[model samples]
Target: MFSPTSFDSRRRTLVSWLLPVALAGACSLAWGQSASDWPTKSVRLISPYPTGGAPDAMARVLADKLSKKWGKPVVVDNRPGGNGFIAIDAFKRGAKDGHDLIQLDSVHLAAYPYMFKKLPYDPAKDFQVIAPIFKSFMYFVVPTNSKYQTIGDVIADAKANPGKLDYGSWSIGNPVHLGMEELAQIAGLKLQHVLFKETTQLYTSVANGDLPFTMGTAGTAGPLIKAGKLRPIAVAAPYRLPAFPDVPTVAESGGPKAPYEVSGWNVVAGPKELNAAIREKIRADVAEAMAGADVKERFINFGYESLALDRKQLADFITSESARHENIIRRAKIELD
Candidate 1:
């Protein structure tokens, strides 16, 4: 028979070895479970646009797809006011997890820092960008019955009339406003800016002849253009859009084109300091969703160009875009009220 001391020693050794193994297995299981149990409840996707806008449309599509992927409901909260501060603020104040996603425009990230004298938030520190949702180039549009047929015609008329050429946009620092400001500056013409409550109002004013010209996304103006209420004179892109094959690019439209290719874009981002695993999962799923045929078709129908970028790439891109806008805004001396 084994001595009691020897048996006790062997038992202690076995227990010691099994304890570590069991603990490790438990830790591994818990780690896996935490990831699997993510999105414990409904996800909130806050949008900075009102109803019937492109961002809202895209968010609803994304919400539905993400809901299916996460096995949870995803809702798009539309809060449209205070130049996107209201929605963004709510997102910041809400959940710190990846469930609180926000649809942000590139201008909000890139140009606002330079445009505003004092911004309310620090974008670099307050958010982690997961991916770019979509892009839409601006269309230099006017009422169909207007005499200005081309970009050059509009420039000539604006020069002759000075500040009488009134252009409209939803806000002052938005890309629709700043891009036109840059174009007008390059062309050396005097123009007046008329701000409206929303994109529908801004584009409607252009169609109603209340506003002579405005740079807007295709989704905002394409229907009116198709309805003969608006005419696109120039596309703020390097090449003409496939959908608008007849519309000329800014360079081709005889305008003084100095990098007039800044397109408006929206991005997906989560709350600050969210868990990295959840963020990565969100990014991966969104990338997969963007690859699907239905999402692609929906984006196309909304006049949005799909762009796919991973988390790191999107972060780097946002940094570079902010730097680029800083240079342009500083050179142009664009200051807002």
Candidate 2:
């Protein structure tokens, strides 16, 4: 039989061991609860474009609204260049705790994978889709004073003078170039692609009568169209935009009714492995912010169609867009240098 003192000593030792385990459990629970209550500090929104571009502008607007709504400073960081790989790399290195978010676009997430032989990041594995902010219509525009009134007229001219007619875009592999190529394939007309280094130059060339026309996002073309320097011939969207009710859609513009839709989409994403609770919180806040009256008005002013899709919806849309762009790129034989 064991002595009473010995039994008491064993009990004490057992208690000593169990106390630490209980304390550890408590600490873990506290930590998890704290994490559940996220946005304890400022949130960083990374924009992969220059300061004046549409993506950057959208990021600023969202950051302002989110900052006010959450009572936390949401900073917009512009890491422009390197085809958005620079900003994406910065985002990957950020905290996985959901304090860092990236404003990603369809080109970087959907089209770049197929356009380039090897992309720097993996769309499926590197990022988690939080929510979609907005969708911008892609417009085919010409000088307001030009004689060609419709897409058919442009196609007729291109066919009549195959290599003489030129259309400009910001760069190769951009949606403008790819969309024009897709349009050319459908219309059975070849065009000389005039590449510009920036949208300002591209639009200026068109506005100055140096180039006949170009394709651009509504955000970039809205002010120009409103100012009467650019005339929208057709919008490559599913339906007519509310902002531009008079403009015809590609389907309505005498083009092949096949889905020739291309638009600039803005989505919020974080590095892979973000906590589910934090992700849901941010998504909910952003969706709510987007639905607010001020945000909606601003989106309309920028000619963006507000989209407040949840994670599953955003994932599905991204997947479909990826497949759609893959087919379009393959058919157009578009490869980046």
Candidate 3:
């Protein structure tokens, strides 16, 4: 017969060991079930822009297709304003089960971190990159009848006039604003920045000759250029855009070829704590969705190039872009006011 104290100690040891084994088995089972039963309910995709913006349009299209593919409802929640902070806040506070997705852009991911001294979220720790949906080629546009016919001409004029030449963008701290500043920095010139509250107003001002020129994504400027209201002087991309092959790239148009390309991008991201398996699944699904015929056609029509990079590649791109934009922000002295 065992002593009473020895018997109690043996029982406690056995219970502790058994409890851990049981818990591990239960957790494994739950993870497997979650992976298998994902999309049993609706998935919410949050767009940081207003309902009519390009990001909103892309999210809606993707949500519809994803809904059909997964056999569940896919809803797009538009929470515009606050420089994308509003949407990001909502996403951070939402469920961490991979049921909620957020659409992010370069400003939110790359520029904001450097522009603001005190950011509310950390890009590396607060969110994970799911997939890169699309990348739009940026173009330097001026009035169709403006004196500047090429990128070289703009650079020359800026060198001569210094701060007299002014460019307009939709807002401060946007890619358009930063890209132009980068161009000026590279070309060794100076120019004034004019901020507009609305995109339509910005383009209209450019078309009507209120401003000399502006940098804009091809998707927004394509229609205007095709309609003969604006002229594409140069494409600020790694290579010439297929849609505007006749137009020369920044390198080809006699601008400094120091890899000064910038564009508006759409990406899928989730809360930082999302399960790895769920995150990968969403990333794969987005890649497939972007490759679909309808999705490809829509992107082509809008003058956007499909990126469709996997999780690792997307993460690498974001990291590199963050570094690149941080340097630009520091050199340009851009602030979020």
Candidate 4:
């Protein structure tokens, strides 16, 4: 029973079990230590929008604050184009140490799945959304010289001349397009959608009275509105925005009373390989940066309302938005290759 061979066999089995456990513990400790000391070098914040837009501005602001806090250089890399695929692809190929982060919008995370049949990146597997940066409501804008005074007038005219009243948006399957489609379906109106290559062209058409109306942000459409070229009939929000207090809500302007709101939002995301501790660290650091006075003022100037959602809450919000977009896309019958 106490033979040397039997004793050696028992010792070998114990060593086999203990060795793996010890190695696992060492690996876990390493991960924790690395996470705690994340951003060992410069960080890259990749943005899908060009340098002038609100998202780009937000990215710069975030980068500055995070850089100061982490004592590392945080740079914003703009790789805009291909409907944000360029920036996403770049992020996928970038570092996985949580130093390479991305700025994604509601469309990229929530609506793209329902809109496209094939995508280069997988929303669930390729990335992790950490927190929401901001949320902005789209304003229903018409020409200043337009005869339509309220959303009710637009609806009535659409009903009177079915398929004659037209609206414009930059692209298909965008928030403005889907939101207007939802509005048409709900109001039982036959309307035509005119597509433009850019916001300036779309708003220019609206101001010239070639297009009846289109949904736009205050930042994108504010200059024309200030120049008396475009008049905001209503905003797709429950309450009036502080920047445009005179503008009425959709319900106030005689749209559906069921709170027909359409808003676009942006969030911070990173590669999925980032550990939980690193993600939380970034989330916490971002929250702190957003709370700064300078960041708050900058967001307001960009017509963006800051969001204070944590990781789980952001994920849930994205899921709910996806479901909402799915319903809208199904009813609107929108699909892309």
Candidate 5:
């Protein structure tokens, strides 16, 4: 046992095991440091919406705040069109160090999976959804001088004259269309859907009495509503919004008694392999950024309600929203190419 050759061989065996462990510990330490010093360079916040829209405004405000916080440039790269695929694909191919993030809406995360037969991106695989930035409720908008006074009037008319009452939205599977269809299904009434190319055309048609009604947001239909061209019969929210205190909720207006609500929201998402520490840091920083007076004012101007949900709560919200969209899509037989 005291032989020099035997002692040398034992020492060599111990060195092999210790070397790997030493290297692993060093790597872990370096990775931790890298995470702590995240955004080692400039960060890019990608947006699917074009400039001047609410989503772009949101991205820009966050970029400004985060840039100041990290002492590095945080630029918003707008890659609008292709139903948000352009921005998503760009993000997927962009920096792998988590310096690039994407802003996604409820349609991309909740409705599209069921609407599209083969989606370009996988929600569960491609994204690490962080948290919701804001949510805005849609109102049941009608012409001001119309015969209907409340949502119940519309429902009763639909029941009395099945398939006569119709609604409009910009697209087939948008929240407005889906929510209205869900309401019709719940109340056992037949209603028709009218499609428009954009919100202006949709709401204008409603104002002109060409379209009976359509779901609209304050930001989109506020001008007409304020001009006394369109009337908001009810808002699809659990409770009344502070800005519109007089408006009743969908339930209060004799909608489904089973608690129905329709809203559109935006959330920031990162690459699937984003580091955990950096992710948490970004979430916390975003929350702080949103709490600022400037961001709050922007939200108010956009008619958006700030959502301060944690990661788990956001995940659950997405799941529930996806399920709700699936139910309506299946019932309404809506499938897009």
Candidate 6:
């Protein structure tokens, strides 16, 4: 007599044994050609950020390095705008064969679904997240002479004078904007949201004290800080930045437990139907490019931490990061229409 419990256990045991075999077969089937046969033509690297920015610079570096490695032209196509939708749309339409790849910010893959009422492309279905290139931490910056000296001071002032304080960023729902929104909720601040059309004017406004606060990466703000034009009120990170050891994290800088500690990250991915083998090859190539001394130096200058995670590590990292953003969106009560 076969008990129901025994039958279910037997089924579970069978699946556990067959799952790996099936996965291996699928991988082999997708890996139809040798590495030399792959990348048979020129590759297009689509970028969401405009030219002359950190993302564009990094994309070009990887393109040049990969082009040399593959013996083909690797071109960077800049389609920056619409909160990265422009480039993502181009990638979906351009590369059915998986040769064309796009650089994506983790925020786009994780936060946009909850930030907007409708997204044009489904993050999980429209692309395959090959691997992460690097991560960047944000800093809470104020004018050098501002009365506010710490992140806690800014929050208290906002509370003391509700809706009187304002912060600036280039776009809506970007990590810069969303991080501030989350911070306000955590610190119970009533502040005004300010938008700018370009980063140049935005940082300049902060330098001139037109805005009370803004978030900037080290590459973006470090020069100004070193020039004695801007002061870092606090860093929105888990630990103190090694470059600026004198500065403190949000909590260390006297703010309430912050909701904006997760650093921003960028990834290289391709069309969802990209061959498993090809995807794996691209991931490996990109990792090697990142490991070069010159590549690391450029990223350092841009205030990025190179991740270069292996396949298993990459999968686990993306999954954990997505879950963190989902929790933040839910807690912040952020829903766009």
- On lDDT, the leading prediction is 4
CA displacement after TM-score superposition, residue 14 of candidate 3 (Å): 45
**Local accuracy of candidate 3 as per-residue lDDT tens digits, 278-319:** 665677787888899988888767778989665446655665
Candidate 3 backbone clash number: 0
* Candidate 2: Cα lDDT at 298: 74
What is the lDDT of every predicted structure here? 0.75, 0.76, 0.77, 0.79, 0.78, 0.76
| Residue-level lDDT tens digits of model 4 in 278-299 | 7667888999998888877876
Candidate 3 lDDT: 0.77
lDDT of 1 by residue, 1-337 (tens): 2233533443343333223212212211122324567988999999988887777888898889999999999999999888899988888888776768899888777778667766677664566666678888888999888888888998889889988988887776777767766776677877888878777788888888988888877788888888888999988888877657899998898886655675888988775556656666787788887788998877666667778765445555665666566555665667765
TM-score of each: 0.84, 0.86, 0.88, 0.89, 0.87, 0.86
In the range 104-205, model 6's lDDT, one tens digit per residue, is 987676677556666787764577677678888888889889998998788888889988998998876677877877777677877677889987777888
Who is ahead in lDDT, 1 or 5? 5
Show where candidate 6 strays beyond 4 Å. 1-32, 257-262, 331-333
Candidate 1: clashing pairs of residues:
none
Model 4 segments more than 4 A misplaced: 1-33
Query: Would you give me the overall lDDT of model 6?
Result: 0.76
Which has the better lDDT: candidate 4, or candidate 5?
A: 4
> What is the Å distance of residue 8 in model 4 from its true position?
56
Clashes of each: 0, 0, 0, 0, 0, 0
Put down candidate 5 lDDT per residue, 1-337, tens digits, no spaces. 1233532343343333223212222211123435568888899989988887677888888899999999889999999888888999999898756789989888987778677767798764577776568898888989998998888988989999998888899776778988888898899988899888777898999999999888888788877888899999899998887656788998899787646998899988877666666766788898899889888887767767888776656665676687688778777777777
Regions more than 4 Å wrong, model 3: 1-33
Per-residue lDDT, model 4, residue 143, is 92
